[model samples]
Target: MVAYKSKVVERIRLPSRERRAAALEEAGYNAFNLAADDVFVDLLTDSGTGAMSDDQWAALFRGDEAYAGSSSFDQLTSAVADVMGFERLVPTHQGRGAENVLYGALLSEGDVALNNTHFDTTRAHVSNQGAEPVDCPIAGAHDPETDEPFKGNFSLERARAVVDEVGAERVPLVIQTVTNNSTAGQPVSVENTRRVRAFADEIDATFVIDACRFAENAYFVTRREDEFADATVADAAREQLGYADALVMSGKKDGLVNVGGFVATDDGALFERCKQRAILYEGFPTYGGMAGRDVAAMAVGLREAVEESYITDRIEQVRELGAMLEAVGLPVYEPVGGHAVYIDAGATFPDIPADEFPGQALVCELYREGGVRGVELGSFAFPETDRPELVRLAVPRRTYHREHFDHVAETAEAVLEKRHEVAGLEIVSNPAVPELRHFTASLEPVSAERAAAADGGSE
Candidate 1:
């Protein structure tokens, strides 16, 4: 049992069916555009959506909002050192902020950065810096039903080929995202980490660990990897980090705080470069873009995230939800994942083509059917790329209980029953939008007549 109590509650209002339809139309069928109040169960993302503990709340009281050299920063650095074993910490507003600072400082025009898989924002940041981002996920990563213990493992063979093709000097960075978010929230093995680090060393490339759900990933390693079967999640995590020269973390996920992230490295010169860039784009070197209170809260959350009981509960809850989704006959990704259950939208709607965005349609129908929100992780998220059509139901940490998952399963079942009736969505927004168009892209049902049949459609 979790050794914590809920100190507060927020009432959730399930909007009427008519209101949901209206909200869908108003938001142009994009779940990201929906107002928080309009949705009943928000699964859009697990990022910064988790409930913090009383200790985290108490840490906020000790925040010292100094202009520079704040004690809160000191606390955050100490926590990062204790849990992550990194000597230097450069705080940022969030994960992407750290990415911008690190990538901006490290990458140059025409350079190449490789990863097991690059989440949307991570890819964008690399491209934005005029560099190329290459994904080398293991084979069958795109196959939703493929049973693999560590589906998140980076392909050493592919990495070697890329290094040979691009020439090692052109590839400056090699990263591995723990609990790889793009394909599925699958955990990476320590063995894979070790190999990737050795390969990076061979190519004289900087090996970085892109971690957000690091603790959850470590828990999975302990449960699945034989060598770690007797090891604590905390020790496994430290071992995983030991292989990386640096780490870019979104403290929002594992930190269990509402907002905060950081880049940790032992490379003093590289750390100095990131600090300079951080000051330009984010904030001061000490606090980054976050407040002292958030920094302090993140410090407590980092330690709490690796606790055996906390990690076990977190991963178990996600596993139970995945089983429930599978019980409803949903084609869920095999072995589940760390933070979310990904539904195979392609299998769910065989008739819906990739260009039409079947995943987005599923998310829209899910909201309309039961006021549940999910995000598409397919053609829409990674436009022009060949990837699995998936809709991710990301569960926030320590927030909802089994009853909430039951409701989500029921909602998914309801949508699946009338799956054929669901139509695909076409992007109607301006094509001039950024590469991450799913965030702001307006989309409409393909069949104008069918859309017009609704009370409020194609507005």
Candidate 2:
């Protein structure tokens, strides 16, 4: 039971989209110099990209002084290898360039990607590269009970079957850790990691890890599993990383700095292959398109990223907020993972069809009432949303405080109470329909000025 005293209220409600932009600053949310401070607690819409020190930000801006590809990048990439326990680690652009590099050799059309769950970008990258995604999270990885600290779902049998059907050459496997955001903050077990590695060897297929939530996953393993009671966060992380050939990371998630991401591999051949593409977009292997301090900060953050205290505190806070919502009879993701609390809009507002994109409307409601911001999990983050939509309230890397969580929760409860009053919208048409294929329409909130005008000069 998360206690909410009426004494604590939101600093203020950002009623208009334009004015909402000023809420953080107006509410004193911008006092922190670090971006991480802005995200980890804030339900604001940030992709956990980076949280750098003031000095690091200054260094990244001096792009001209940046060594395009420094030995420092190689050192950093090697550090990633050491942390992940892979023989090779490749750094690549997060954009189309990386996909192009993947096409001719590493990936093939009609091939399949088996992961615990999918992120829109990963799915888009894979599908566009000519493969479909297959997520095999441990049964109930998303459920509250019986799931392991590390929910390992890639059974040897499942791995073999996938490889047998797709051909080892075409079937690649991925394991996403921490909050299987798509599956609601489910953690994958380390033992499962060991097993999957064995399975990959058994089937002669490559294994990849989507490590966006790696730090949170490590924290869970240490806390929930008795077997790892003595393990440090870094040890658990290294243990899990050792199981895969390569891993993709979003700098926003684990990297301490902002605006960057990396791909790491253990295979020398694979490293060489991805290197060619890195130059096209991410720059040389040594620099990896990251500025000196950004890399320097990551080197520091990576060390800090595995700190048990930081990881535990961050995840526990999310669960606390989740418990609050669950107490209110609202549908939330069963398990709590780092950085988010998922609202099961479909269950909370069943009258709206899953395909109707109710998440779009709910987003508008939350934003209007409390200025609580979050992204839509339905069509917004996936291919289609409507019948069973999920609204993801992300607490980015560093964004809020204890009061902020309660503030967001209280606002959520208010919206739920009044959800019935919200009018449904009709889609007129989509312009960028191709890209829009996976995009759920932005509910497109009105600007403060526009909304005020519509309200007819009301204060």
Candidate 3:
């Protein structure tokens, strides 16, 4: 791979440490509530936080601000068809909006929606529709230390069991999240996609893909998968997407855009159904929920996201950060993923009880220590699940350089060095509704004495 020169062209001022701490306290310990200016190194998510290229910015100016049949939408349609191999495009505001429309159209009450693993919003949307969201990920997916090449793959046995128990008729669709976020951002291999596609076909069920990180997933397939070892990233991506009957994308991610998403399919009937919902919930069929400028930016972003050099640089930055953390004796998920490094909070803070949310504690400490923001993928994120607590540091594409990652790693090391001083947090208030409570959950640090007692009592 060839190296490309880049430099930061924009700057923002950060708030004082005292202000940041007070902001965290006022926001109920939720990093999302902190002002953007207070964050020194924001790693909250890769979605919609990436820096667009000059070409994308240039396209934005060319946007035709029409409510119907916009030229910008035409560009997006062409790009989606060229890269994703989909025959129809149904745009939406973002990935979750696409999920809402697609699930609303296909799923009925009590229907089962199976996936390798359902990320937070996907699970919430399925559950909100009175449908069941079943995760069939390989057993290794839950083990942060597991070195499985494709930890995000759906287990064939588990998939079969779900079908047998739920009945084929009750299964609406099977989803495959590329670079499965819920499973440490691990990539689902081409073989796994083929297997799932075949199985879904056998059951006459739709095989849909959550393609938010499809570009990164494709890069992994080319580099890691034997069959695609010699293929280009674009070729690998096209082949991987070919296995899906339909796909939903968050343009904020792999599309390399600031904001946009779409649901694409080849089935005319399904497209019509999804289109109706898109119009009803999002906007007109042409622009969906995005403006013409956003559509134009997405068109250029989709093209750039598949570039070999771009993805190689992006994944390497994440790996560099993971190495930095691991060198400090932090327990990080092995076989570093495409977009982020996941810290095993359970292992790192073994004394911090799960119910108290060790992951949440770690997240807060990172912010307070260095104004660095990250997200927890632990019990708080999935209340009923027994998955190990994890803290994810998601790297935005083209937004930060190596220096920024080094700073974050240093902050993580600082936090780890003082791990014994940290105390877990407890929810003081929760959303009135049970679905997706983590977003608005009000949490406070557990009393220092109680935390000390729990630490002393733990093995």
lDDT of 1 at 356: 79
Candidate with top lDDT is 1
CA lDDT scores, all candidates in order: 0.91, 0.60, 0.89
Candidate 3 lDDT trough over 10 residues, lowest sum: 1-10
Candidate 3 per-residue lDDT, tens place, 351-417, comes to: 6889999999898989998889999999998889757799999998887877787788788889888
lDDT of 1 by residue, 1-459 (tens): 655567799999899999999999999999999999998989999999999998999999989899799999999999999999997989999999999998888899999999999999999999988999899999988888788899999999888898889899999999999989997898899999999999999999999999788999999999999999999999999999989888999998999998989999999999999999999989999999999999999999999999998988888888999999899989999889989999999899876777779999999999999999999999998887768999999999889888888999999899899998888888888445365888889999888564455325324
Q: Taking the tens digit of each residue's C-alpha lDDT, what string does model 2 give over 1-459?
A: 321123222343334545544543342222111132222234643354334444444545543324565544654665576665665544443323333444334567787777666655666667676777665665545454443454434545555666677787666544444446666556777777787777667656677777766878888788877888899988988887777777777666676556456767767887787777767766766556655656655555566667666666667767887888787767876666666787877666665554455766676557656666566666544654211377777765544557777777787889889876654433443435333342433233334565445457444
Ranking by TM-score: 3, 1, 2
**Count of clashing residue pairs in every prediction:** 0, 42, 0
Q: List the residue pairs that clash in candidate 1.
A: none
Clashes (candidate 2)? 42
Q: After superposition, how far is residue 348 of candidate 1 from its true place, in Å?
A: 0.9
lDDT sort, best first: 1, 3, 2
